[model samples]
Target chain A: MPRTNRQWSLARTPRGRLTTDDLALVESPIPQIGPNEILVRNTWLSIDPSIRIRLSSTTPLGYLPPIRPGEPLVGLALGTVIDTRNPDFAVGDLVSHIFGFRDYAVIGTRADTIGGYGLPTRIDTRGMPPQWYLGPLGSSGLTAYAALTEVLQLRQEDTVWVSAAAGGVGAIAAQIAKLRGATVLGSAGRADKVEFLRQELGIAAFDYHDPTLHESLAELAPDGIDAYFDNVGGDHLAAAMDNLRPRGRIAVCGAVSGYDGAPHSGNPDLFQIVSKELRIQGFRAGSYNHLEGSMRQEVGGYLTAGDMVYHETIFDDLTQAPTALLAMLAGKTIGKTLCRLTSE
Target chain B: MPRTNRQWSLARTPRGRLTTDDLALVESPIPQIGPNEILVRNTWLSIDPSIRIRLSSTTPLGYLPPIRPGEPLVGLALGTVIDTRNPDFAVGDLVSHIFGFRDYAVIGTRADTIGGYGLPTRIDTRGMPPQWYLGPLGSSGLTAYAALTEVLQLRQEDTVWVSAAAGGVGAIAAQIAKLRGATVLGSAGRADKVEFLRQELGIAAFDYHDPTLHESLAELAPDGIDAYFDNVGGDHLAAAMDNLRPRGRIAVCGAVSGYDGAPHSGNPDLFQIVSKELRIQGFRAGSYNHLEGSMRQEVGGYLTAGDMVYHETIFDDLTQAPTALLAMLAGKTIGKTLCRLTSE
Candidate 1:
């Protein structure tokens, strides 16, 4: 074999809606493996809302450089190594990387480092699906763990209200809070998600498309809410402010509602925060890099003991990647949406 | 001499504006003092914005009960004892009690107690004006202290931004932060207040009526702010969110901006909180009742050493009480406003 490769590159800057034509699939010479480099045959790719932020000139994160046009779109993916020069990784082993949107990736030991480390390892998936690495057992899992347990210091007996409860991060967070013995309540867009949260996840209460969400929450937790895990910002955050009890805590994780539109203009009733004596904090999972070991241990144990459950919406082929991404952005997909690049 | 007593009672509830006619002064027969009661001649009464909340049925604090149609309006006051049946208090002793807006009060031994004990022997005026006991060394002072030092855990080297810098709590909070070696910047309403904060209080920087407050704050704090003491909570809060550094802390103390009007609507850019990893907390002075001894000690020492300064616009008599309160609510007063009932 002459070592063939295929990669997708950004074709142009997107103004409003991005189309498949905006990404160009190109045939390129396979990269040569250097000392401390590993060549991976990409198997799966994760599409997230954070990618939309990277696509534009504005990022609320305010730290990373803006993505330029005519460059490769960078994101997370799972792959198996076909060739390796790095001593830490074997040729037959699997790995995850901050890989570009490509069919194959050549990852160096020092390349794609963020918060001062390379990508995570791909341990035995056992009988579990490989796509689980992109959902609950991966970045989304770490995000839920860090925000709930570390940043918010969630108590087992506390009442938790989560927004976007059907999305990847929100779904896992609600389950984790329930597993921790919390009274969990979640909000989603459709009736199916509401039923999923109530019947499948054993959530204490669930609401969908309720215009009186604030009043509904008040009625549900008449004694008042102890903590809120916010994924959808804007109106949801404002409602959380009103429903929070004295000394309530909020962990701000994501803001999918306003990501594609003009920023929300109304100021929250901050007076409630003052009079009720609440605490609101923001967190990113990347900041908790050291906790990866503990998180993996705990979450892995939970999965093995049947205390945790997860769902995934899989797109069969790489050609459907654009549709999957669009569905995820529109919040039409349930749980974690993944694009399967190759058959097992 | 025959004993005579005069009491002021609420005659009617004002629809929009309150006047002296709303309160009626009537002479009453002096009742016999009970076994656990002490009769005191009201000397000084402290009027505050919190009193306004108690006047309405929809108060958020839920502390004082709503005033009855024809009952005496009660508040925090300083007085002198003329007769005592309680063993803990003696005649001729000066005391602070939760009974005011009247000429005399039959304070129960259980009612006039401080720290579960009877009132202290004497108040130390210490070259500072006696009115300060109602402003800086009083409940308002404790509120600012508790929120900034305890709840917010403000650092000595932190850059602090304060809103309503010329008002009672804000003026004292700004000075306190400066004393703790923090770089203090503040926002007030008028040019005179800006000058007062800069020249009189020695604040590092200040702005008045700046249409571009957000831009001005960004320029002042190029590195970003470490902590904020929020008093005026609408746009000021949004501006603070934009300028906060990572891991920044905000102590929400009051929301005078939205106090009298309908609650302001709209989703503020709370996503900034998540991206910056900020911590925002609300605090009440009552929560830190354990710190009363230490807080008074420190504030009293500062006053005695001439390190802290305060101002009060005094209304001459009980008839002018409503006007003084309206002045404070309208932002007409420079600092704390109180009503003096007697020369003694």
Candidate 2:
């Protein structure tokens, strides 16, 4: 058994493009489980861009507090209980929790009930990959579901645009909107990802780097879009406003375009919101935990039956978590970005 | 009786501050009404900032169309039927319609059916002034009601901020929100307008020109506002975004700040929207005609009982319509700005 535990802690708040100097990986001894505690070996770590917001020292106004220097970065991870003094989590039980960037964790909790890392949710893979629990069935999946059904309240035959369509949430959002009988037009960064969307997702996809995004949007959605699932705010948002039909709806999932605190000159003349009668709603999926079961059953079925194909860029070690996040934020990753710790 | 009808026609689209040069008051002989026609004598012309958007040659997309050079400006107005060959309408009945900056209008239509100027529905004033159909009981009133009940869906005990607080819509909105038991803070242009908000409407009010607008907002809303009724949407919008509580709602009525086509630099960071989980909905009351009856009954009661007081900047004649609009746009007017075409 491995007694040494390796973990990454935030070294400093990142200013622009993140480098490894911003995070420090250190080796520590794995703590033994006490009574009513469970010892787990973390096998996978989920890397997300939201972690960058947490790494900001000043901490944005209304989001979660900043992670202090030298504190282990907190995020979702898949782990297996190797040893336990608690009754419910027996040896060899598979679970997911906020063991974070660490390779091992020992948490004191009632063995009979599950703790809330939100997605540590007990999922039945039903012969599918458990990793599906972290991607198509994780926070991204739930966010896509909520944005489509509740936020956008998409009507059949509505034309939709998904920004960051190559990402975890946007990819699924496009598919779900398509499933709801709407035309889905999406924007990604790379040509390969754009191809992936058209070929695999069967939707109109364009690259944001295209010289004429407006023309591309016009060609793709000639009649104009009825809904916009906005993951990239700035120019993408402005373009959507220009192309949105009257009484359009915008489900604001993320602001990746302007997340680094840079000037985004393309903030649309908000008057268009009234003139076009648009509804822009900003949402956090963690607040929609009530819809978890239904989303799991619906999106989970698509994953299980091979009706929905999801791709991910996975790193082999925990040291790659920071790099993975940078890559994802840089729009280099094709799907959900994750770091693999143990080979299942 | 006047043999000729005088109407103001657009001379040119103004580049900056609107002047008399952009509009020309022209006179034409009144045409005889046909058997199906009704002749109307225009009494009061409603002057709103939205007219500026229409006067722009490059019509701001999606709202009302632009007025061509030599075409009369179309808007809401209070008038009376003077001659009707049609059976449904009788001479001397107060009416409202889009007679368009004119002193007399003769139309060929069944006196019974209403035209779609979007308003001028047969309103029962019940001893209240018929011009009330253009102010507190008009589109502005319906706008306030719809914004509070439908757009914001404001929760009780909410702290609200209304920008352009002394104007037609904002004045009524502040009162309605207060009646709903919310702590309402408002911003107007002049000291007198601010005083009107505090003294008559019972809302905490401030002047936007105050050098300490940000400090004043912070002091007024010690915690944070839960909702915003945005009429002037430049710095006030930015300030509101900075001071909104989590899950705050913004009902975007208009953007008078940029109505003159000048650049406004105070657009809020889009990330704050996602972080705070705000819902910003833009609406026009014309689109929400469904709420007319309920709003009239409830708000009408307040107006009849004198529980709600409304103020207006009334111009004495048709020639003042252009100047009244410019004054209203400059925030020089309190409450509704109307050109009183005649004295009964």
Candidate 3:
């Protein structure tokens, strides 16, 4: 086993736009495990936009505190147990936890969870891609499922719009809603992503940048949308409000537009909430972790039938993790963005 | 019966800050009632903020069409049916209908309802003040009751904030929540209204104009509020988001700040909705008219037992309906604002 561990750490809080110098790859001796502890060698890292909220010096109230400079960045990861002192885990066991951006993690039975999820649970890959635990059959899948079923209460008669359709959660949400027989419309920031949504996912897709967003949406749904899966906030949210029917619903999964260094525009005409009698609910998948089993069952069925398209933009090795995050944040990556670490 | 009827009409859509000239008190002949119709002499006019939305040249999509110049304004009014050609009504029957801003109204069996509420219905006043059917025992009361019970789903353990607490809906909402055993905080625009909220309504009260809204709210609810009843939107909503706890809820009843000709501020930090896992719902009381029976039962019990204080800012005669609306909009009036028309 390697004696040294390489981990990504925040060098400084990012300003308007993130730069390479803002992050550092730090080296240290592998952390020793105590009784009831398991040492994991991470094989995959999930690069999510929400972590950007912690890279700043301040976070929104009630959210996790900011990740200070020189501190290791924490996220969802899939790893193998290399050394185990806990009876529940054995060497070679594949597990998922909330200690990522690193080569190795020393986990205890009481490891921290992200909003009640990612509790260092064992994963049985059953010969399928083990990395799938960190993607579609995991948190991303559950997020989409919970938002659609619980928050938006999506119905078959509903015409729903999924924003940021090229991203991790949006892609699954758009496909799942369509699979449930709802008329779905998807929006992405780039032409290629839009094409992927139309051809690969087979949904009505649009580039949010084309003309005005409201006009693009109006051209597609003149009668107005019944529900919205919002992955991007700001203008996207405003546009969704402009096009939603009376008694419309919105499930806010992420706000990628505001998480970056860009200044908040605060442009949404919230009065739409009153006029249209709209319902807007913001949620984190971790809050609904109980739905994970049902999520895996359905998503796994789609994968086995080859009816679902699970795409990934993977960065090679630990050194590329920062680049992967930047690419995802700039809307340059499609589907789930991840870092593949070569386990020795 | 009087041969002439005086009605309030829109002379021109107000540009910014409505003035007396924007509305005109015009004279018209009282129309003869036909079969299935009733001629009512109006006694009370309910001056509400939502009417300002229709006075503009354009309204929010999905809302009722704007009232044009020379068109008579419509609102909820209490009147006595002096002449009836319909079997469902009789002479001297006290009733409530959407035909205010006039001294006399000819109501058809197919009279319009507001958002599915406000249908012309007979009121048994039962020896109570007949005008209470226009104030606490009517639409304003129903609005507050529906917002608290249905929209907010208020709990006894919750600490909720009601904005515009001295106004028609706010006053009732604040008291109803307080009477239900929830810790309530009330906010009003003026110092006198603040005093009324504290001394009369018997709740923790603050002037929204004092210090900063966030500071004032934080001072009272340092731990954080669980639900918010939003009557004045814009900055008030921003403050609520800043001070709400995780899983917080907001019921959007009105946006008095936006309804006037003033430019919208659009200053609320919507990202709070995501990070804090907030739930926001906008509704009109008309949608929950089914709950009106239960609402009147509980609210009426409060009134009979001297547990509720119903305040009214009354203006004599139909000529002051415009002034009453302006006063309510400017936050110059307390509780329910009404125009007491002297019926001939």
- Give each model's whole-structure lDDT: 0.75, 0.82, 0.90
Better of 1 and 3 by DockQ: 3
TM-score of 1: 0.87
Please provide, for model 1 over B51-117, each residue's C-alpha lDDT reduced to its tens digit, 9 standing for 90 to 100: 5545554555313356655777776677777888888787877777666777777877453432222
Candidate 1 Cα RMSD after full superposition onto the native fold (Å): 4.0
Please provide, for model 2 over A241-320, each residue's C-alpha lDDT reduced to its tens digit, 9 standing for 90 to 100. Answer: 89999889998888887655455648677878878778999988877878888998888777767778798889878777
What DockQ values do the models have?
0.52, 0.74, 0.82
Off by over 4 Å in 1: A1-39, A61-65, A81-93, A106-133, A262-267, B1-38, B61-74, B84-87, B106-131, B261-267
lDDT of 2 at B203: 88
lDDT of 1 by residue, A61-162 (tens): 444445667777767788888888888888878787777477788888663555432664755787666767677777888888898898779998899898
Per-residue lDDT of A174 in model 1: 88
Q: Residue pairs in steric clash, candidate 2?
A: none
* Reference-based lDDT, residue B206, model 3: 95
Candidate 1 chain A, poorest ten consecutive residues by summed lDDT: A111-120
Candidate 2's error at B338, in angstroms? Answer: 1.7
Docking class of 1: medium
